[model samples]
Target: MNLQRTQTAQAPPAPRPGPVLAALAAAQFTVMLATSIVNVAIPQIRAGVGLSEGGTTWVVNAYGLAFGALLLAGGRAGDLLGRRRVLIAGLGLFAAASLGAGLAVSPETLIAARAAQGLGAATIAPAALALTMDLFPSGPRRGRALGVWGAVSAGGGAGGVLLGGALTQAWGWPWIFHSVAFGSVLVLVAVAALVPPSAGRAAGKFDLLGTATVTVALTCLVWGLTTARGTGWTDARVLGALLGAAVLLGAFVVIELRRPNALLPPQLFTTGRVAAGNLLMALLGSVWIGLFFFLPLYQQQVLGMGPLTTGVGQLPLAAANIIGASLAPRVSRRIGATATVSAALLTTAAGLLWLSRISADGSYLGQVLGPTALIGLGLSFAFFQLTALAVDGVPPQDTGLAGGLVNTTRQVGGAIGLAALATLAGSVTAHASTHRTHLEALTAGYRTAFMVCAATMAVAALLAVPLTRRKGRADGSRTPTAADPTTLPRQGRATRRTPAA
Candidate 1:
């Protein structure tokens, strides 16, 4: 077996990829596009569906709740079944859900349909990432692939804002969903034709108990945080939901400890890089998602910009993000992923600090653009570096799980952090209103939120200190082993190496 494996590794590599990457990137982009595409259209959606403001919030939360909670299960399913199979299934589900959301007549129906879309996203994201990892062997080639993926992933939310505004203004709020639905169908077809079949399934039983517990816990937690923005943290329903989350999460931990085929194996967490990378990703998500959520509101309400103008204003960010992502791979090769991530975090913090000075009468060009560009650049760098580092030492069989875990942190952290920040912003606004005009009060709230974002980024940078150093090969560069099961071989049977960088 050892001799066979050595011979296989020395064999010729797979053919150069062509359309495969484009399809995978499109799949990822569409899933993330749903996250913020509706933000600018919230008012239009509310008016169209006759939704109360609270119901409107659910339109967003329902999707987040489902997406954040089910990511792990979806990832594991891809590993147990087949990555390609899961990706196709997920895309199909998303397309159908988007159709329902686009056509729904009532808020409840739309929210449910949005939840279905989230479920589809949950399934698609992990599988798509795992497939990308599978297709691209780590080295300069994988780095380039990840650079593209990272740029697309980071830019997707900003792109969504742009696309959502245009679609909503030109057509209607429903077109936002319709557009994604149509795109999903195209990408699904492309994926079916371009992506090769999965090598085989992993040997394992689905950890049903573990899956249920973690999913329920995350759902409860995200739902509670989202609900608290409207209902207040002290509200009984919010409190109960949070309590239920704690209980469920506790149960999940116990289940994982005992289960043989756990959804989130405990050993993964014991690794310093995995643990640190995930925690940092969560912090970054908090700030990133918070910025995406609030910046548009600040621009529109405070700066008196229209939806189209607001979307247009964000174009610099999208452009800057792509530039930064494109550069991160090469930068990491020089400075190491850890240092690159840490510097990017600090850069983001600096940018947030600068932006925190936002006033009631701030100029978009003067105050907003500079910091927005800086943060965008920093985010792209941090996002790609963190993603690579997070899965650095994991075995091929567990690659899907690693992808799911990191993505889960991103989604869940954004949900929880946004809630906490929103609460803080609300309190600040209310207090400032006693002494200032409404606009001034609102500016104070936004500024305070930005300061908190800066603080969170600073903290993440501090945590990254230990991660800056890693043990690599004798040349001080990490190389991918041929036994990596994530890689698709053009010649021989799939086999896996023991986990290493």
Candidate 2:
């Protein structure tokens, strides 16, 4: 009895809920805010910079390409340099870049600045998430923190369009960047004042070679895919870029296998949970990203909705996202993360199927609102749960890398999925246009895309079934608690014990 009491007393305390969680969520919000914030301001940016329609696209792609490609390096940097230090450095870079973008006088200057902003975002995002995990001891505390994180992340994406529209119409396009810069400043201050310091740097040299290989490979792949959206996939440049990416990626694999200190440690892939979680994230990203990208096109081109109205129309999705995120922890506690995710994917797929039935003349009230809400809610359920699962049993030292992998899968998946789905939709539309009216062709294309999205979600659901069986059957078959020894800081085997989730 005395031994038992002593052991219980020595156990680490549960992480108390606090303001640090809010600051971390704010950091995530600011990082994601930049992603879609510039979308609605495109017309104004083009007019100001005297950009051609094609050139304006670079404004968005520049940031995405840089951000998506550099994420692994950034996460590893945080692990080596100290997450807090790297986070501060990242925020500084983001602020400077946003300021430059706001004050830019030419398209070249703006695009360059956007790319710099992406670099900063890549640096900040993984650090923020890793820090959140460190601060919130796992279990309900971690779940709640993740709930807020998911809400803000999704909210930022949804709100960007609305905020951009309002700022562009009322203030100016530059104000969009200006506003984000201001918010970032506030978040930085909160982080510095509120969040605790990260652990000292891990014992490893910076993997510069690995970083270069992976970053260049990802950039090439993304560039090829994005370029193919406009140019044919068979274009010589696109083909060359894709081939180069494949070769570089192969080199990166070889380098990681051989290197003593690699950017992404081989141990990360050893866990089936991490691997499967990332795969599921990719599929979820593909469906949702495709939906978000094309829905606006359908609205503006097919239904003739204005930018402001379209932004407003997305309000349901935003609200439902918050609702679902808030509830995911409770649901996962009862049913397990794997089951929650599987159910949510099926729900989202059902919603996507419902949406596929929309006509060219579909009204927001009749066709768009219900399905959007459903998708948003379903996505929210899976988003945070998958995030937790990806790093569930990882060593504390690998947290940033785990975060980076999760986000990387989602971003890359979204980019590739959107490009492929859009290409398919375009082909169908063009072929159908030959025999059908313009509206009918457009509707058919959108419907086909929606159906494809539904199928993708179903596949994700099927994959999630194995997640429930991975481990933790004795811990009530629920999500693993945050304080599980296997997930704690790296220590001797004697210090670690396998705990059921």
Candidate 3:
């Protein structure tokens, strides 16, 4: 039988993104904004929401768990339902959860709402990515658009810390959640008026088991880490939770690899860049956010900076990160993705190594600025290039799942990084307090952690060269101009193509 030729259905074209893509991106901004905003307000959240040290972490953990776990499923759902439908639905749910979280009177309720917010994110992010794929189909223009999109997603997260600090200092922690609610309302309205109704198609039934397994596994691991905060890493429950998480996550991998409708294709992990890119994302994500988590302590407690000042002090990193993320793609196009990433990773590593030298009296201008800017420049070049290539290896049909995997790696990496850094800092602080002041020892712990971050990024940088330009693809993966460094392997030269959705 001859295949029926059909034009893919298009969104109703508007005179600009009056209410469509803008709304989608905004909703994304809001959902992402929520996670980082609370980081700055953790203290007030504990006091107001009755969050204990361990319990307070759940406020962040719950959202991350739900968000990370269901990401693949949400992508699948978007493909089955209309991406627009899934995107809008997710936005509405996110707004509702934000309202609940803002008014939460107890720790348990706050955690619950936070988890709900993650679910909302799970629903939205993948769908938004997929929709963007549909809206901006592949080409050079698409590549530039996607580059801008990546910057918005990344830069917005860092900005959220500053905004949250401002809001928390000026008003209260609740405004953080309320802010999301207001943004969501506007996004929802825009989406309704602008996004066309879709009779969407699905690949198959929802993968509830896959989603549940991932969620439980990540939650267990995080819970174990939280438990270790008080009970020690060797605690039986902590050990069991860690082991259980390992097994469950391993099972998730096996299941996904084997399933007919897998959450992620086994093929993706087999590629050099795909696998390596994900690892880079994981390592960088964990280490990057871990710094965000603790560096504030040095500012607030050691230097006696207020919340606003602490957030401002971080501007070096935040501002550089924005510049880095935005400029990275264009840089990669010139240097070749592999070379760009490798150089950037080296820069990041060097910065981290320098970061390890920070003392209580360490000047931000010397100790912080050089490393932060270096890391920013490096991260900006590396991540966007990797993102561009992530889906390049796959077909358009699998974009949603591919996008989910890219996202999943980052989430899991950040979680692991945060826990490892926190655990190490805790041990260092415990050991040092006997001889030195508590504050002094804590600063020592921060320096030690910075050393680890530096080492981690350095290792990743070393590995990126082999990963980006392997025996397979050439450095540019195309006719390498002086501007482009990544080439494809000779054998697959015919098969390799430019960026597609």
lDDT of 3 by residue, 188-279 (tens): 88877776654346566666677788878888887888778778988999999999999998999888777876666678676435677777
Q: Pick the candidate with the highest lDDT.
A: 1
Order of models, best lDDT first = 1, 2, 3
Write model 2 residue lDDT over 419-469, tens digit each, in one string: 678777877888899999898899899999999999999988987897544
Per-model clash counts, in order, read 0, 2, 19
Cα RMSD to native, each candidate?
A: 5.9, 5.9, 5.0
Candidate 2: C-alpha RMSD to true structure equals 5.9
Q: CA lDDT of 140 in candidate 1?
A: 69
Candidate 2 clash pair list = 138-482, 139-482
Error of 3 at 278 (Å): 1.6
Off by over 4 Å in 1: 1-16, 471-501
Considering TM-score, where higher is better, how would the candidates rank from best to worst? 1, 2, 3
Better of 1 and 3 by lDDT: 1
Greater TM-score among 1 and 3 belongs to 1
Worst-scoring 10-residue span by lDDT in model 1 = 482-491
